[model samples]
Target: MIARSTFSNGIVLCCRSDDDDSLLAVKCIDIDECPTSSLVLLQHEVALTRTISHENIHTYSSVWLSKSRLCMSSLFMDYGSCADIISSHFKHGLPEKIMALILYEILTALSYLRSVNLIHRGVRCSHILVSKNGEIKLSGHRNMIELSRDGIPVKKVHDFPKHDSSMLPWLSPEILQQDMQGYCTKSDIYSLGITACELANGYAPFTDMPSTQMLLEKLNGTIPFMLDETTVAPLIEDTSPSANADTEKFKSEMIEAAKSRKFSTAMHQLVTDCLERDPDMRMDADQLLKHPVFRQIKGLSKCQILQPVFEKMDPISKKASARVFQEQEEMMDELNRMSMCDVEWDFQE
Candidate 1:
């Protein structure tokens, strides 16, 4: 283990394996002695992780109560979140093809969740994880809720419960209008559309406004384009100004430029379907998985495309490395002095 931290109700420890030195993280939530909401959420998360074994969903290797702390260990994602990439790089937005692949992976995981009648209440850039292998795992399942067999929530989740208001941008209009109650799995579709927009434009629309105003706009506002619709530069192939090339020819050039844009017509339509204001009008996860945007996805992994981006952000200073080495040596010496230390003898110097 390299580092640890304590939060209001929990602790997190960062660990590396002895063999590969690969990263792992364990979250330990303290629930005191009561049967509180924190304990209920922890149990639900562990149970869902155990049952949902999809590749795009994070799996917990172990869960145990360690001295009043519910500790759950899982793989550590290396490259950071989509939100992180946007805030650092690609501020204007990512290319359409990359967004397509990302949305496809999320929809795949959501499809599995739907099969079990689960609704991932939160879907946003921060919750999407990217790894070196191009794998996309969905985290932030603390708000996930189960529905009846007919796809309806048995209990009114929001009648008495409070939700994070920061998630307003990614939530659906229907839920916001109804005071965040009586929503179903279809609500996820709306958030996915907003998330797609966030990935395309580097931020969700109307984020500068207060959450209440944003919700009002969603209820009675014009639909916004999910992708930035800037025209591509006109091609110079057959552009010798001719005597008879008039306004008609100029219009044709503009049309061709629009056609050359990267965001596909099908992708625009898919976003519209997803963002339909009517709850029943939105496409389900199954239909979303079959959208034409996914057809344009290339088979390359996430790491192949994002490794350069990660490297650009990972310039460690020599001074920092030296300090880290010094700390490592001190830790090693301390461990050596302690009789309880049971470190592997084959560790490289």
Candidate 2:
């Protein structure tokens, strides 16, 4: 195994095959630790992936149950994910053109899913895998909703995903509201908008707030915009008379830095259209694909479009090593807090 990472309910192993020398990501879940509901979802995910085929969508190569663990293997992506890229290289987010190209490909995948009557409930940067060759594929289909029943289409769905707490931030407000009027595929568009902001800002907005507070913010139609030169700077509040000059200077510096990161009006409008508070008002995947921002890369090949981003990135292996170390530290901290193991192994130099 080259490296491994743990999530709330599973561990993903990055390894090379002995026979073919091909890289693979094997996601394993301990059957004993996994709840019955989660197990069902895993099975559903496998089935769903098997029935679909798209260049921009990830599918598993094999799935098996052995040694009290459910293991599924898929091709390992070179860049890991958009989130990984942001963490390792683009700390303040990606370039506007690169983000536009990535989102364009994502929209293509979404359009395909919509045709098959599937709602990819998860649409965050972490679920969007980036390749060394500039391809972006959407994963995280474990929480996907099938909008058709017995060959009949369902307009809206009311059920909530109980899979992960981290998804709460990306969920649409209509889903969070839980009223009589349920959410449809449009819900994913809202999440796409959030993902765009995450791509442009390096981090998701409202993540700092508690779940309930974040829920309230979304419910109140507080949409997060791209953090770029065009975005208005938040007011700097300082009461100290001695600190006034320092605050002004700091604010001026922030403005100057932001000036270098200006995004086009079309990009801003696309995000605004997708993030409409009302599900009906939000642009669907097909509509979003037609947005003006996507036109910027109409004739460009994937390599041409993403070459700058690739050039800007640090070495993938170095980034992965650093990220793996950080993830290990976090996982160890969480495991210790749970007190499931009596013995502790220190991983310090």
Candidate 3:
């Protein structure tokens, strides 16, 4: 038992024990206010969390049901959610290297969850938590949707409402149409794609619109929002024009490079693949982890570019000494060639 404070519809408390030391985030609901089926879904979430064991996921500690409140406990992350991280250090956007690491960790976590046939129906920055050392843990597991033996969503009382696709803007197109027959692991990929876009843009796509309007726009095939070199300059100029200039330059170069690198094409392709109008084209978590982009990033680590996931990778994946040496040489040559030319930008920072 520890100190407790109450908030709307729930209570927050500090819980400490020899076996557990973490913050307890408990949401209380009147049994009568919430549907009985919803209560069952909550219990299912607790069971699912209790079964999963992963470093990148918050550990489920305990669940308590008293007369009126349902309390759930999990490991406490000192740092706040990814929403906090994005708002703090990555307001404009994060460096490509750091972004790659974050995406890799997220993919890893999604892979583990998918292995058990669970789809984190809600995948967003707010649902991710970062530890003190920058390791990411996918929290809010209670929101995941369990799948049937055929990999389709189980028709549960808490499942998405038939007419509502407005809750999560990042959901796959298939989900929006109420196409339960087509929903599968690929749906999570669509959410991940949106998450990537959010990571790069510093906000949710089309965040300016109301939820209903956003959903309508998405259903009508509107392209989701993104921040490019020109877009980034305006938002970040006050902080450091020079750094923004460099970032914009890098973005332009990276876009060109992606065009040629089949695996490293703009993030849009991967995102769009996950958001395919036809669900058949979407990629699963395992397939995404094995993408050429991941392989290209493996090459980046060898150049002594200390990105986030590089340190956590298995030694075998990190062994690119020969390739790294060659890449460095080529990079130097490219830099030397560019030094002789004058570059002008149409967009002002």
Candidate 4:
């Protein structure tokens, strides 16, 4: 293994073949450590991903049970998730060109999923993985749902997605309402718009609020837009020494920070279209694919579009890579002292 990283229910091993040095990301679940429910979800993800065939959708190359461990392997994504990039290189979010490229790739994947009657309900930054070659893949398939059942088309689904409160900021207001109208693919479009804002801004909208307040904001038609000079409202004057004054001062500081950067009108418009409170008014994946904002990245390969951003990210990437190696080494040493070393198992693909 080249390196290793721990996740919620398992660990991911960065492995290289001894002969050809080919790399693979092997997600391993220790049968002893994983709860039965989590293991079933992991297995279900592999089964669902195996049937999906798209350049922008992540798929498992192989899955097998080895002794007390279950492992699923796939092509290694070097740069990891867009969230990783934001945390490491672009704390204030990515540039418009790069954001456009990322969104374009994700939309391509969503279009393909739509053709198969699939709703990629998990369309967040952490679910979008990036490779060094500039390939973007959409993951997080455990919560994906089908729009049809037994060859019958279902217009809307009333069932809620299986995720925690952290997913509320990305969920559409219609979904949160739990009304009789139900929700359809447009829900994903709304999430895509929220993801766009998350990419353009450093953090997600309503993230600082309590869960109930966040839900209220989305339900009350509060839309999140790209943070830029044109969008930030002018600060109102408040000279009195009161609680409201402190709040106004805070707003003033936020507006000034927003004014430090400028974004194109097309970017703002795209976010607006995606975040429409009415699901019927929201743009679908196909419509979003044709948006003028994507024109900025026209005719450029993913790698070509991200070249400059990658150049700026090289030093940060190198440092992070080194840290991973060091941590993995320590982890391996600890594992060597464990009594499970004597265990052996069959491997399958």
Top candidate on TM-score is 4
In model 2, state the lDDT of residue 130.
Answer: 77
**C-alpha lDDT of all candidate models, in order:** 0.70, 0.82, 0.60, 0.80
Candidate 3 residue lDDT tens string, 286-342: 777776555446745322433332333322112334456778999999988894358
CA lDDT, candidate 2, residue 138: 98
The reply for model 4, stretches above 4 Å from the true place, is 1-7, 18-20, 234-257, 315-349
What would the per-residue lDDT of candidate 2 be over residues 164-224, giving only the tens digit for each residue? 7779888999988888998888889999999998888777878767989999999999989
Could you arrange the candidates by lDDT from highest to lowest? 2, 4, 1, 3
True-vs-predicted CA distance for residue 96, candidate 1, Å = 2.1
The TM-score-based order of candidates, best leading, equals 4, 2, 1, 3
lDDT for position 287 in model 1: 89
How close is every model to the real structure, measured as TM-score?
Answer: 0.72, 0.81, 0.63, 0.83
Cα lDDT tens digits for candidate 1, 94-137? 76767887888899888988887778877888889776667788
The TM-score, computed over Cα atoms with residue i paired to residue i, of candidate 4 is 0.83
Q: When superposed on Cα atoms, how far off is each prediction in RMSD?
A: 11.4, 8.5, 18.2, 7.4
Clashes of each: 2, 0, 0, 0
User: Compared with the true structure, what per-residue lDDT tens digits does model 4 show for residues 1-349?
Assistant: 4334333367787777565786788888788887776667666677778778999999888888999888888888887888888877776678889999998899999999888778878889988998888999998787777787676989888878654456778888988889999899889889988999889876778776787998888888988888777776523333444358755565565566678888888889898998999998888899889999988888888898888667766633455579888999999998988786577876976
**Best-fitting candidate, scored by lDDT:** 2
